[model samples]
Structures are given as C-alpha cells and as structure tokens.
Target: MHDVIGLVLAAGAGRRLRPYTDELPKALIPVDGDTTILDIALANLAASDLREVAVVVGYKSNAVEERREALERRHGVRLTLVHNDKAEVWNNAYSLWTAREVMSEGALLVNGDTVHPVSVEQTLLQYRQQEGSEDIVLALDTAKVLAEEEMKVVTDERGHMRRITKLMDPSEASGEYIGATLIEGAAVPALAEALQATFERDPQLYYEDGYQELVNRGGTVGTAPIAAGTSWVEVDDHRDLERARTIACRY
Candidate 1:
C-alpha cells in the first residue's frame, strides 16, 4: 500500500449559496447540527485511517484557520492548510493544482462540500489495492438519476473512463462522478501537468477537465460504483443543504 494522505478541495466561493457563503466558504456550511460539510469530510477521512490531511483553503480562509486547532483535535488528524489565492477568481482546477506537492505522495481526494459516508473512501481504497487497478480511481454513483449539474462519466466495456465532463448528455452517461477520487503516487506528475494545462486553457475550467486531459492522453481512469441506496449529497444550494441534513444524520 502507498503512503496516502487525505486531500480535500474546499476553496470554492460557492456564490450560489450566498448568505451562508457570504462570510464563510461553502465547506463551512452546517448540514447536520453543528457539523459543517468540512467536518463530515474530515471525519470520513479520519475513519479511513488517514491521519494526515491537506485542505486547500481560500474565499475567507481565515475562518478555516481559526477552526484549525479544533478540527484537528476533533478528528485526530494533523492538517496542512494549502492556500489557493486564485480560488475566488479561478475555478477548482487551480485549487487542485495548489495541492500538487501534498498529492505527490498519493491521496484520497474528496470535495469538501460533499457529504458522504466513510464507505465511499473505503470503496476507493479497496479497489486501488486490487490487481490491474488503474492509477486513478473514481467513486461513481451508477444508481442516481443524472442531470445537467452532475459531473457525468462514460466508461468503456472494461470500466476505464472514456469521457468525464458536465457538457455531456445525461442519457449517455454511465454514472455520476461523486467528487471522490484516489490518485496514486505514480500519477501525480502527469495529473499536475494536466491540471496546469486545464487552468491555462480556461481559468474557469473544473478539475474534472484535468481528468479529461489525462484521458485524452490515453491514461486509464477506473471507477468504483458506490453501493446502491447509500445516501450522499453535494450541497450546492439551500435545497441541497436540506437534502444533506436529511442523509448526513444517518451516516
């Protein structure tokens, strides 16, 4: 097994989630009681036995900084804060790129705003340990109904990703990429380069575009389907926040 750390991308401004996001980043929004979205993310990572974590912060980074000690004490993990100065102006491609150094050792990557169980992390790690596993593996939700907002995936017969983008038609998608990925140490250099290219091509491009760049270069990206009926939600709006509250307490 590789020495993997938990990596979280929590730098988005999340403009659509205003008021809640006016003073804090989207990751700081409370979904269940006092447990913020980032808290669930850190808790899940800690439960997966990842003691070291790197969180990319921006868009009111001070809020996260202030809670750093409390979060570390609560989760029992040492955190390294990676600052993304461009997080407010650019999209997540640059935010992800900011953590390239930490990611070099390999990482179980999760979006900070996603509320999911520890099982999602376990699934990705288990798949990565199997024979013939790809260097990059994504946790996919095949049972969910796809929509334009979902980051959809199209895979070939062998389960290698053929396409990953939000622009694709939902009917053609194999599943939704649920903002979780396992990146092996061997894939770091290429992924960093790909992320650079993606952000340079368009500052507003997503980190998923970096995945597409790798796919276009003939890299194999594998997938692990999340167990059917498992509850998860990516809180992008008040409606999604309400859904998160409903499912998160169960986790």
Candidate 2:
C-alpha cells in the first residue's frame, strides 16, 4: 500500500453560511457539542489509520492554526496546514491545487465541511487495495436523490466515471459524488495540471471540474459507492448544519 496522507480542503469562505462563517471558515463551524466540522474530519482520518494529515486553510485560517495542537492531540495524528492565499477570492479548484505537494505522496482527500463516518474513508482505501482499481477513486452516494446543487456523476457500465458536474440533469446521474476521493501518487502530476487548467479557465469552478478535466485528458477515474443507510452531511448552510448535528452524534 502507498504511504497515503489525509488531505482536507478547508479553505472555502462558505458565504451562504453567513453569521457562523463570518469569523470562522466553514470547517470550523461546530456540529456536535464542542466538536467542529474539522474535528470530525480529523477524527475520521485518524480512525482510518492515516497518521499524517494536511489541511488546506485560507479563510479565517488563524482559527485553524490556533487549534492545531489541540486537534492533533485529539485525533492522534500530525497536522500540516497548507495555506491557500487566494482562498477568499478563488474557488476550491485552487484550494485543492495548493496541496499538490502532499498529493504527490498519495492522499485520501476529504472536504472539511463534510461530516461523515470513518466508513467512507475505509471504503475508499479498501477499494484502492482491490485489483483493477483506478488511479483515482471517488466516494459516490449512489443511493442519494441528487439535486442540481449536488455534484453529480455519470459512469460507464464498468464503473469508470464518464462525467462529473453540477449542471447535469439529476435524473441522468448515476449518483452524487460526495466530497471524498482517493488519489494515487502517480496521478498527482496530471491532476495538478488538470486543476491548474480548471481554475485558469474559470476561478469559480469546483475541483470536481478538475476531475472532469482529467477524464477528458484520458485519465481513468473510478467510483466506490457508500454503503446504504450511511449518514453524511455537507454543511453548506444552516439547514445542512442542523442535519450534520443530528447525525454527527451518532458517529
């Protein structure tokens, strides 16, 4: 197995979250009592046996810096903060590109704002160990009822991703591409180039667009379906935060 690192993209300003994100980045917002979104992300990575974790911080990054020690102790993992200088002005495609160095060593990437159980990480890693696994494996919520806002994916019969975007019709999607990915070290260079192209094309584009870019360039991206009844929430707004709180405690 590759020496994979844990990567979390926590740089988004999450403007829609308003008051909660006014001072803190979306990742710092609390879900469970005293346990913030970043806390859950770290906990899940640690539970998956990832000893080294890199968090890309930008908006209100000092908040994460201040809690670095405490979070490391709580999660039993070493923390590395990768700063995204343009976090406030750019989108997550740039945020993800900022972690290219770490990604070069292989990484299990997770969205900081997402609250999920360790099973998601475990599933990705498990899929990586299987024969015929693709270079990049994305966690897909095949059972979720996708909406326009959710990042959607279309796949071939062999489970290779054909397309990924938020603009596709929901009924045409195979599932929602939850904010988790297993990236092999070998794919980093191509992925970095793809990401750079994606952001340069449109700074507002999401990192999922980079995945599409990679696919367009003939890169093979595969999927791992999250187990049925698995609970997860991408805390983008107050309503999502409330849903996160409801399920976070269960994990």
Candidate 3:
C-alpha cells in the first residue's frame, strides 16, 4: 500500500446543491441518519489505511471546521484543517492550489461532495501495481457518461487519458472521471506548472483546466478502470442528494 496523504477539497460554495447548502457547508449536509457526505469520505479513506486527512474549507468555514474537529475527535483520525479565503471569487481548482504546500507525494485528491459505493483501496492498489508508468492515475468509470456540470475525461484505447474537459458535450465524452485520483509525487511539479500558467492565463477557470492543460502538453495521465457498473454519485443538487441518500441506504 502507498503511504498516501489524503487531501479533501471541501471548500466549494456548492451553489448547485442549494437550500441544504445555503446555510451550511456542503460537506456537512447529512446523507443519512448521522453521517454527512464528508464523513463518508473520511470513513472511506480510513478504511483504505489512508488515515491522515487534510480538509480544505471555505464557505461556512466555521461549520466545516467544527464538523471536521468533531469527526476527528470521535474517530481518532489525524486530520489537518485548511482554510481558503478566496473561495467566493475562484473555482475549486484554487481551493486545491491552496493546499499544495501541505500535499505529500502519492497523495489522494478527494472531492468532498462525492460518495462512492466502492472502496478506494482497489484504486490505490492498481496505482501501486502500475509502478513507474505514469504520474497521475485517475479512477475512471468507462461506461458512464457524466452530466454537463461534471468533469469528463477522454482516454485513448490504451487507457491513457488524452483530454479532460469540465464542460463536455455528449458527442465528445468518453467516460466519467470519478472524484478520487492517485497522483504520484513526480506529477506534482508539472501539475503545479500547469496550474501556475492557468492562473496567469485564466484565473477564473476551474482546476480541471490545469488537468486539461497537462493532457494537452503530453503529460502522462493514466486511467485505472474502476469497479464497472458500480454506483458512484456526486451530490450536486437536491435530486442528487436524494439519489445519494437512496444509494447510501442500500450500500
């Protein structure tokens, strides 16, 4: 198993998941009887032996911090809390950049809003088995096409992702890029470079822009095919929340 440090990006405004998120941070929105979305994410990480979790918080920052602190206290997992002040002006990519200083090599970048039915241990294991082949190993669901609001990844026949686009047209999408990804330490410098250029060129763009830039520059972004037909839900709207709740109960 990789000595992975998990960076959970919980700093989004989550405008899409309004009403519920209108008052509290998205990570705190309850998914079930007691577990919040972020709670599930942390539990998943803990199960995979990735105990160290750093959460990046922005909107409703206090609420996020309190929730994280409580979870840390109860679970006894070591968690580092990070804050982003510019979340109102920037997309999630900026929230990610804010945590780059704390990011460790072979880090698992997890989106706080995502809840997966599958274990990330399998994904991490695949990444470890691949050895020195690529820098970023994305967990991909090859059969599903995500919605327009979701990030899309287009991989070649060799399972090498050639392009990643935030705004995708159905005619162009190949698969849904899941929220969890394993990034090798070697890939960090290039990712940082791409992000720097992106901020200079279009500071308003999402972090996916940087990933796309990496692909455009011929960076090695590999794809690991994850549990086919497995359920993976992104809680972005009320419907999504209901769907996540339904799936959460069953899973």
Candidate 4:
C-alpha cells in the first residue's frame, strides 16, 4: 500500500453532548484526566502507522486548531487542519468535502470525537488487503446494544452493507456504524458526485446519508466487524465522556 492519508472529521457542533460542549468543541473535550478526545484519536492513528493526518475543524475552530498543532509538536507527527465554514448548517458530509484535496488516494477517514481500542489499526489493515475492489470499508461495532438515537447497519452474510438506518428501532437493528471508513482514490470522484447531489438537495444531510447513497448506487461498501473485545466510544454527551475517561485511564 502507498502512503495513506488520514482524514479526521471534527466539525460537528455535537448538540447532543450538551453543557459539556458549551465551551469547547467535542474533539477538544477532555475524555481522560487530561487527554482530550482528539489527542487519543491521533495517538491511536499514529500507533497504527496511519500518518499524514488532516483534521477538519468547526465550532470553536481556533481552539481545535491550536490544540492540534500543539499535539503534533509533541507527538512528532504533522497534522493539517481544514476549516469547515458550513459546520453549523451542514453535517459531516461537508466536513469530508472540506478535506477532499488533503488526501490524494489510499486514505482513511475517521470521526474526531470517537475513541476505539488499538484494534482500529487492524480494521484499516483489513481494508488495505482488499484495496481497489471495494469503494468503502466501514467499521462496525457488532456487540453494541442499539439505542434509538444511534445509527444502525444491516449487512448481508458476506459483510456487505445492505442498508444503513438512523435512529433505528433497537429491537430490529443488527449493529452500529462506528464513524470510521476507508475509501480508495478511485471512489473519490463518484463519492464526490453523490455528495454534491446530496448537498444540492439538502446541504444538512448526515455523512451516513452519503455512504448510504453509495450503497444505493451499487458501490461496493464493505463492513469490518470489530469483535466484542475491541473498545470504541463516541464522546457526545457528559455520560459518554465519563465512560471514555474510564476506558482511557485504564488503557
């Protein structure tokens, strides 16, 4: 595999996170005793040899950018920061659009507010093995107990995505879509076209909508089912932050 670029989408306002997000962006929210959510994310990626990172920032972009720079200086890995001016109006699909040029090809995409166990590297490696055959490789937490608010995924026996449903009924859902994906360079143009169409229709559509569109268009979107042993969390609310803190402190 060629040198892979990494895109970290950190632009959402994270309204569900509430008072915790009242001051800083979700990416900068302290998950552990001192480590911010973004810090742990970058550290995990760096550990996986997934370098050349670019972070898309919004909602207190200055603080996120400053912290990103400081973390890069300390970690010895350069981080590129991209601004998402439409963060308030658009969803993470726009955040990914902002980093179109940041990654050339063979890139990995992840959400900044999420933290997963070291197993994420292996998930990426799984995609590397498939390469150009798949348009997108999405990570799924197969063991998560589905709640009403979380996005859910349904897949065929072969792990191909059947359909992505949001706010799905927990009783009927199969697994959760962790906000991480790998898209090859060949798929970028088609993905871009779908995103543009989505924006034209509704600029505020969620990133999952775009991925679902790819599935609708016969694009090959595969799933990597992370076993129950792997740790993954998205620090969107105070409770989630505390949960992540507990895990991070232990890790």
Candidate 5:
C-alpha cells in the first residue's frame, strides 16, 4: 500500500455493442442492478485503497463527467479527468498516453469495459509489494478457459510477460491479461515512449502494444495470476454484456 493512482481507460465507443451504446459509452452501461462498469471499477479501486484516480475519457465523456461529483463522493476518492480528443479515431495507446503526467507517480490501470471482483485489484497490489518485483505487473487469468476475444498473454519461464495482444494464437498464449495492470513509476517513460510509438505507427493500436514496447526496451513487466474461482468478464458485445450481468450480480 504505497501511494498509487488508479488510471482507467474509458474512452472506447464499444461499437460492437451498437444500440446499447447508441447514447452512452460502454463504461456507463448497467450490468448489475443500476451500477455501471466504471462504478464497479471505481468501487474496486477505492476498496483497494487507491483513493486517487484519473480517468481517460472520450466518446460521450459528458456521460461520465455528469456523474463525476457523485462518483467521487460515493467512492471516496479524488477523481481527475484526462481527455483524449482522438478517442474515436485513435486506439487506447493514445488514450493511455493522455494520462502520462497524472500516472507518473505510479498507477494501476484497468480498462473500463471489464467487470471483476475487488480481489483482482488486491492481488495486483500484493504482487507489487513482493521482493524483486518491477513497476509493471499485469493481472493474468491463467486458470480461466481462453477464447479468441480475450486479450491473450504469453510469459517466459521466469514469468515476465513476453507478449500481450489479442492477435496471438490462443494455443500460444499462457493466459489472458484481463485489463488490469500495475504500471510502476520506473515504467513511466518507457511506457510513454511505447504508447507514443504505438499511436504514431497507427491510431488503432491497443495500449497493450505499449507494454510490448517496454519489453523491447528491456523493461521487465511481471504478471499476477488471479486465484482460482475468481470470476471476471470484459463486455465487448451483447453476449459479453449478458455474461457481465450474470456474474456482476453475484459480486
């Protein structure tokens, strides 16, 4: 429990979700009761004691801004808004790069579309405190069944992440990233450079590509495997949204 900032990437339009996102961004979509995906994210961060948070917003950002004061009061955290004007055209690499200054102190980043228990955040913090650990730690779901839609990861024998992307073969992946990561202070510059390169190469690049950039620069990014029986879902489409609702209420 050192001082850490919670960084959330909530800029995507979630086009695949279509009509559900016709007026609202995916983060505002209700999954359990009336709670939103971003609500769960904020609650989890607050529960984990990461009380200061920065949210990168785009694609109907007013939806999130409108509730900013209430969400801050409810979660017991100071919330900062970072805007990504290219959220619609560029990928999350740029969205993440937008928070470079706020996250320079240290950050725990979670994608806004994911729904998981607070234990996921807890496990990540615990791992970060371990000896010989670095600033970058990815929350991995090694026990879960893999699928094409999930962001896949491959690690070396020593457990450092070797690859993180959805384009890899499922059979080649060691686990799924689950969109939660501890980006330590030491990783700030490398991550920033990587994210910049990723966005410059193509606006459609994922922030995970930034992690790969850090690796290419010889940065060590650890992986924290979620415990067995821990449930989570990343809502990208109608079917995924249904799964989120099913598991969310149980949380």
Candidate 6:
C-alpha cells in the first residue's frame, strides 16, 4: 500500500448527534469502549499497510490535533491533519476537495465515522491488486438492506458504477457504499474535477456526488463487497453509536 495514502474525512460536526458532537468532531466520538471512530480508522489503515494517513479535521480541530501524537505512536503511521475552515457550512465535497494535494498521490478514502474491522480495507486493497483494476474501487455492502439515508450505488453488469446517490430508489440500488474506496493516481484529476463541480453546483453535496460526477465524465469506479457476516456501521446518531459499540467489539 506504499503508493496508496490513507485519506480520512473527519471534519463533520454531526449535528444529528447533538450533545455528543458539541465538543468533538464525529471522528472522535467513541464507538467501541473508549476507542474513538478516528482511532478505529487509523488502526485499520495501519493494519492494511497504509502507513501515510491524512486526516481532514474541522469542528474542534484542536481536539483532534491534541490526540495526533498519541495516535501516531500507537498506530505507527505518519499523520497529516488537513484543516477545513469551511467545514461548518460546506459539505464533504468541499472537505474532500481541500485535500487535493494529499490525494494526488492516490488514496484510500474512508469516512472517519465508519466503524469496521480491518477487513473492509483489506477487501478493497485485495480487489484492486488481484483484479488489476484502475480508478476508484468503493467498498459496497451488497448484502445489506438499503434505506433512503444510505449512500446507494447502481452498477453496470461488469460492476462499473452507473449511478451513486441516496435519491435512488432502494430497488434500483446495486449496493450500499460503506465509505471505503481505493482511488488511483491516474483518476485523481477527474475525481478532483468532479469534486469541484459538485461543490460548485451545491455546497451541501456529498463526496459521493463527486463520484457520480466522475461517472458522468466517463471515469471508471468499481465496487468490492465485504465478506459475508462481517458487521460494520457508520455512526451518525445515538442509536448508530450503540450499534457501533456492539459490532466494534466483534471486530
């Protein structure tokens, strides 16, 4: 994974989580015992051999910075904290676009709120290596039931993504994108362009919308499904946090 730097989007305030997010960014919220979501993400990236990790921080950026040294010592990965000043109003499209420099080296972009085992990262890496695939390879939960809130995906028969958005009907979705992806160096420019277009169109657009724009530009984005019976959750609220707590221990 030398060529692949780990890029984590950890800037969101997670308003839906309310008091829990009042003092910390969503990435710092503890999911498994005292191990925070960012901790899990960094640990997973380290396990996957992604030793160079860039964390885009916002909300209470200082809080994450305070923990940076300890995280690096524990996980053995170089950490670059990219501060996002517009994190309060703009969405993750802008959050991701701000990391254009780091991502230019190619990246394994993971949403910091997601709590999953190293298997998720492993699956994405193995698929990219074994298949010799190019461009982005998003981790899809083909077995999971989709909901309107989920970032859904629709793919062609050959597994290339056709559409990726929450607006799509669950019936039309091929799978739910679990927020882990392998983005190649060659595709970084298109991804950056797509992210720019997405934020320009609407500041509230998600980074996933950027992926859709990439597809519109005829960029290839593939999918890799996690192995069966592996549990993972993206913690966005109190209930999801509880679910993460339960599942995280298994990991």
TM-score, per-candidate, Cα-based? 0.99, 0.99, 0.92, 0.92, 0.97, 0.97
Report the C-alpha lDDT of model 2 over 1-251, residue by residue, as the tens digit. 67899999999898989999999999999888989999999999999999799999999999999999999999899999999999999999999999999778899999989999999999999997798898899999999888888999999999999999989899999998889999999999999999999999999899999999999999999999999879998988889999999999999
User: In candidate 3, which residue ranges exceed 4 Å CA deviation?
Assistant: 145-147
Give the range of the ten consecutive residues with the poorest summed lDDT in model 4: 124-133
lDDT head-to-head 2 vs 6, winner = 2
Residue-by-residue lDDT tens digits, candidate 1, 121-140? 99998997799899999999
RMSD for each model, in Å, please? Answer: 0.7, 0.7, 1.9, 1.9, 1.1, 1.2
Q: Which stretches of candidate 2 lie over 4 Å from their true place?
A: none
Q: What are the lDDT scores of the predictions, listed in order?
A: 0.94, 0.93, 0.77, 0.77, 0.91, 0.90
Residue 13 accuracy (lDDT) in model 5: 98
Q: Indicate whether candidate 4 or candidate 6 has the larger lDDT.
A: 6
TM-score of 5: 0.97
| Error in Å for residue 10 of model 3 | 0.4
* Candidate 2 vs. true structure, TM-score: 0.99
**Between prediction 5 and prediction 6, which has the larger lDDT?**
5
Error of 3 at 61 (Å): 1.2
lDDT of 1: 0.94
Error of 6 at 70 (Å): 0.8
Residue 195, candidate 2: alpha-carbon lDDT: 98
> Which of 2 and 5 is the better model by TM-score?
2
> Candidate 6 versus the native: TM-score?
0.97
Cα lDDT tens digits, model 3, 120-156, are: 5467555677556577778877777667776788878
**lDDT at 125 for candidate 3?**
51
Tens digit of per-residue lDDT, candidate 4, span 89-146: 8877777877777765756788888887657756766666764446678888888888
